[model samples]
Target: MTDRSHITLYSGGHKGAESEFGQLAEQWGIQEVNFSFDGHTSIQRTRGMKVLDPEELDKGNVSMEIVSARMGRKFAHANKIRKVIQSIFHMVNNGYHVLAVGWIQPDDTVKGGTGWGVELAKLFNRPVHVYDQERNGWFTWKDNAWTAEVPELDRDTFVGTGTRNLTAEGKQAIHDFFTRAFGPA
Candidate 1:
């Protein structure tokens, strides 16, 4: 029997976001979709019975203008950040590690939820690992920033190079790293 590990993946639908993580997850038989519901965009692609419709949201009588105003921000997009936080908790409650898949820029900086999620994870004192495409290795929160040695990824803005896929070796490293982190499950 295969020891399948449940992990929450922080990434977008782009090739760069999903490439290495998706490959490694598949190789280790891990699942990225932790929560799925109707009209969740990914529901059709995933098998989930939990149904979620906007009827309740509509009933709340919340204005789209308000939503748009809050969701659209200069530095922090409320929707994405809030969703990332919520999903991080959801994944943790369901026994899944929060993994952020991102890239490192030529100048070395990370933005968006890929970077912000790690910040939130640190505040929550949770374990957050990243498959850094730029450095071509696995990183974890430790001390005050991302480190490849010891244990844990610390708080720091991840480097970025924009959306990009991982190489074959990078993908394998992801699998190996997770195995070491979780150990047989």
Candidate 2:
């Protein structure tokens, strides 16, 4: 219990992660943040997504002349991304960790959440934990087993074991990952 206030649980925030984290957050008192776009916006930027000019998302404050075709559909995402970035800042400024758990794709690169979750964690000197849904276990940025070993991910090393559940043996794999990632020193 290291005052996980600064820790923002950054992840895909998928259903199981969300469900489990909700309970874990309540019991452990943790601040959590996630990147989400229901086929629209992203926390920062994504290809094919319509990037707003800040005014489009701010209807009440900044009036726009003509709403773009993508404005209305992307309004909620704009707001959501704003809040998530703000939360990341809060955790970083306050000195916290961001526990990242998300989908690991083939080719061994973070498809999307990697930038928001892994990159930020590295920048802020926080620990990041990744979950491999397909493998059903914890994985690091590097390991020969990784589908595509990333150099950036490999350059950094971990204080503890990177692969906690090699086989996805049990239901408590993620829980165990938290224990190793944020547990007492």
Candidate 3:
């Protein structure tokens, strides 16, 4: 009766390792949902703009489109929370079963990227699998801790797991996992 299906990958857009990881997820049944702020504009547009228009607060689609343009150099940080919420809702409403969040290290800045995925996992009650080269970590009352117990992802650089190193076997594993979690697609 339950039509559990589809896995979504939320990463720091499709660039560098993040982009590569998205491709790997595609190999599996997991669909990479590019929540990148860059989808709205071209690189040329992001050149010198400083701040996003306040009016964009109400017009997300238009604001986001402008943000995507490279002319402003507008980072995806300012409205990431809203963006993730929108992205999650959009995907889930459309029938995605699980979400695979991609993350990188150096989690201290304003828009630390992985934090969005982790937050979304908690928000959606989905189990989060984080793959990073700097050891696996989990939040705690005092501080987060790292260990070897976390699941190792395929090494597509983006996957950043010890076991899942972007190999054919690793890619297959991701596909199987997504299928099991989200159902067919």
Best by TM-score: 1
Best by lDDT: 1
Q: For residues 1-185, what per-residue lDDT tens digits would candidate 2 score against the true structure?
A: 46766444433233444435434543555554433334443232121122333343332222221111212222345544553333333333333333334555554443342234444454556544456556565554433343331111222122111122233332365456545555632
**How much lDDT does candidate 1 score?**
0.44
- How accurate locally is residue 71 in candidate 3, as Cα lDDT from 0 to 100? 24
Error of 2 at 58 (Å): 14
Better of 2 and 3 by lDDT: 2
Per-prediction backbone clash count: 16, 4, 21
lDDT of 3 by residue, 19-80 (tens): 44455455554544443242334111121122223343233332444333312234556565
lDDT string for model 1 (1-185, tens) is: 36554443433333454445544445556554433323345321232222323442233233334433333424435553343334333333333244655653333334443544444455556666666766776666677577774233232111111134446655556556556644563
Cα lDDT over the full model 2:
0.38
Ranking by TM-score: 1, 2, 3
The 10-residue segment of model 3 with minimum total lDDT is 42-51
Clashing pairs in 2: 6-96, 7-97, 107-148, 108-148
Worst 10 residues of 1 by lDDT: 153-162
lDDT of each: 0.44, 0.38, 0.35
